[model samples]
Target: MAKAIGRGRGPTIIDVARVAGVSKMTVSRVINNEAGVRDGTRKAVLAAIRTLNYEPNIAARTLVTAGEARVGVVYSNPSAAFMSDFLIGVFEEAAAKGVRLTLVKGEDGLAPPEAELRRMAQGVDGVVLAPPLGELPAIRQVLSDAHLPTAVVAVGQPTGEGISVRIDDWQASHDMARHLLSLGHRRIGFIAGNPDQSSSALRLEGCRAAVDATPGAELIIAQGAFSYTSGLRAAEWLLDEACPPTAIFASNDDMAAAAVSVAHRRHLDVPRDLTVVGFDDTTVATTLWPPLTTIRQPVRQMAATALELLMGAIRNGAPAAGDHLLSHALVERQSTAPPNRARAPAPALS
Candidate 1:
């Protein structure tokens, strides 16, 4: 009998494989009673299991090996609040399914190098790609070549090659813009998110469509990188203009918070002199002096749904290709109100 190593937690499938002198896959096959193992190898694996006292969970037997099924999550987003919520959902589902997660951080919203991606593919059975990183064509091609199950979260549209989990960004933005219009905000400042993300363009288009449909409505666009600093700069630019907007709509909560800060610096009271709103409805939205009125994108739910899709594909031994559109809601709060008529910008000269 092989000596069992002492682990502080408990005996794992890896320990069983080590004692049996076989691969982890072989141990998994034995545990699940799958065919293709020689009688001698099977007996050796069973003996090792008995010696180590290993217990396999249902997820382990039905899906891939519990300890061996590695799923990679790649992200390069700059928003801490959004990432915090997303990671929570992922970890919860992964723990429940008895799966291991391998996190890979990309640089400046770009995917890792081809060589690094290839190396990662060898270790992971599937991958979950967060926004901006999933929009890259090279990254998609590389993963497709590897034949790994993949799930992309928060993209504007489904890529059709992998599982996509997201809210309808265009419609959500459109609804938010319409809400502002209904509040009598004719001239609204629009702060866009990162250009590299497909959601940015779709969101901008949605806001534009809403503005164009309403008579006398005008939109002043400013670029943002989905960071607090970028939001500050954009808000300052919009507020310093000859005819400043009465209301400002930022693509995310961080930018919206910056707009509120700029309003305060100018001695403007929120929803009195300036109406501000944002999207994503992250924690920052409510932590401000006046809670923000914005769109709830369900970030945590989207992450969990993506992980579930990836795991299902891994179990079925096929690529997961479908779009899962989650529901979004317009959350009303104290930050948005009817634009103060006295503070409205002067009409442009004909």
Candidate 2:
């Protein structure tokens, strides 16, 4: 049995173990999110820790461990806004665990090739991959061959052989599309992310599902590269169609912001003349004149969770292969409204 601690004395791992009816090592494993511990045992330890308000002495533990855990995070997406938010979360968690995080961007503006990724995995204990990087079969094969622990974040579907952290992109996008349909916008234009990314197909599917269920709703899709510039061009093309949509849904906040710019160039009033909604409620979502209506993907939390998964995999000497699903939200702002009474004239599609 563990005795109650006096003031100024923090709850220790032994206290948690006693309360959880497990050994001290079990408590430690739970705190570090290490594998090998049974799920039921892990939960009991966690519950005990929560009850005791326990905080692990991570720095001291790192010293005892001798070697620092090295994690490589690979990304090649063009959304600076998304990356910034993600880094903040990853950095916070990495610092807490005394783990080192290295960012590697591909030279070709895509996920690093298998050879390049193999080089990155040489020294690192584990890797965190984002988007197309996570979706690459070659990257998965090379990392698997290298015997490195891995976590995939923000992917449509995790390769099913490693830790995957993501929100429900399909349901989130579907909800956003329903929001537009509820607002009386029947014709919606969609600007897609890079087709190579799994999110592109998943999000598009969600939007199509919503539109299909609504009467008198029509969807027009424009291919995009998931860049602000791509959003601008895609929005231009959409607005120039034979019958332009009254609402535009861009797959990301960066593209949505670009859509706002295009609307302004055409001298159209947002929400009143054209409504725009975006996925990923990143900083760009709020920075726009009319704050964008979007689906909040919990970018920071997802990254933080991915880092945790990676660290645990490193400590346990096993790749954690499981889907970690987080929550998402629908954020309504000034950028959306019911369709205007009089529709604007359309130009050429190209």
Candidate 3:
């Protein structure tokens, strides 16, 4: 029988290392199921873990014993701010876990060629598909056929194809729209995300639902590719109308920043002449003048979680079933406020 600690705290990694008569690094390697320690040493660590009843942290609990596991991360997302944050999380977690990562970038909004995917499959134990790429069924099929465990990030919902880590896009957008409505903005223009991704539709649906539920509220929709340039066009389209919206809600920070630019170009004072809000509170959200009111999507955390899931699946010989929905928050910044009904439109930039 294992001896229990007198203190309330449970046995830790250090305790496991001590009981096994090995270094903490050894214990970590054993916990991660990495190749290195001799059979005897591995057995000793396992025995200590069992005897002490030590529960590894969530990241350490996934046992990938075949070898030093290699994970491939595939991304084709257009948002630089979002990708920068997400890659930081993934790299940090992978480094801590002592796993190798291979990055594959899709070209022209398409998944990596079949030959490239096959090569990637041979080199890596599992894969993490970042958004836009995650939405591609062909990519999923290729990975599936390769028998590689997979985890997808930023998908709107689980497709029963692999482990999914994302937030509830519909609910998040709905809440943002509700925030605008509460602030007394009834005519709101919504700039949508890339149509190729599942989140775009769900976000639009969320905004529409909120507008439909409220009396005297109207929603005007414009398409965007989740790019700053696309946002520019969308914002221009909405603002050029005979009856322009008092407020604009963009599906992401890039679009929201563009809306702010447009507002500035027309010499309209934000919140006094127009109120702009956005989702995915990325780096651009705060960097902009009059920082945007937006949804904090936890992009970095989601990427980390997805990688963890991919590791777990690689370890267990099967992907974990179901979706993991992380929480999102509406961060109120300087951009949103009650509409000023009496304001007049200023002259457009020459």
Which candidate achieves the best lDDT against the true structure?
A: 1
Candidate 2 residues 1-350, lDDT tens each? 44586687888755665576544434556666655777777778788888888888874244324546668888877888888888888899999988887778874347666666767765466788876688887777776665566788899966687889998889999999999999998899999988887888999999999999988899999988889999999999999887899999999998999989889888888989999889899999888799999999998889999989777654543336789999999999999989997867345333
- lDDT by residue for model 3 (1-350), tens: 34456597888765675566544445667787776467777888899998988889864444333236678899877788988888988999898777899999886457888788878865666788888888788888777655566788889867887789999999999999999999998999999998878899999999999999999999999999898899999999898877889999999999999999999989898878999999998999999889999999999999999888776654443334568999999999999889887874454555
| TM-score list, all predictions | 0.80, 0.80, 0.80
List ranges where model 2 is wrong by over 4 Å: 1-64, 107-109, 113-115, 345-350
Query: Where does the lowest 10-residue lDDT sum fall in candidate 2?
Result: 59-68
The count of residue-pair clashes in candidate 2 stands at: 0
Tell me how many clashing residue pairs each candidate has.
0, 0, 0
Whichever of 2 and 3 has more TM-score, that candidate is 3
**Candidate 2 CA-lDDT value:** 0.81
Instruction: State the TM-score for model 2.
Output: 0.80
lDDT of 2 at 139: 77
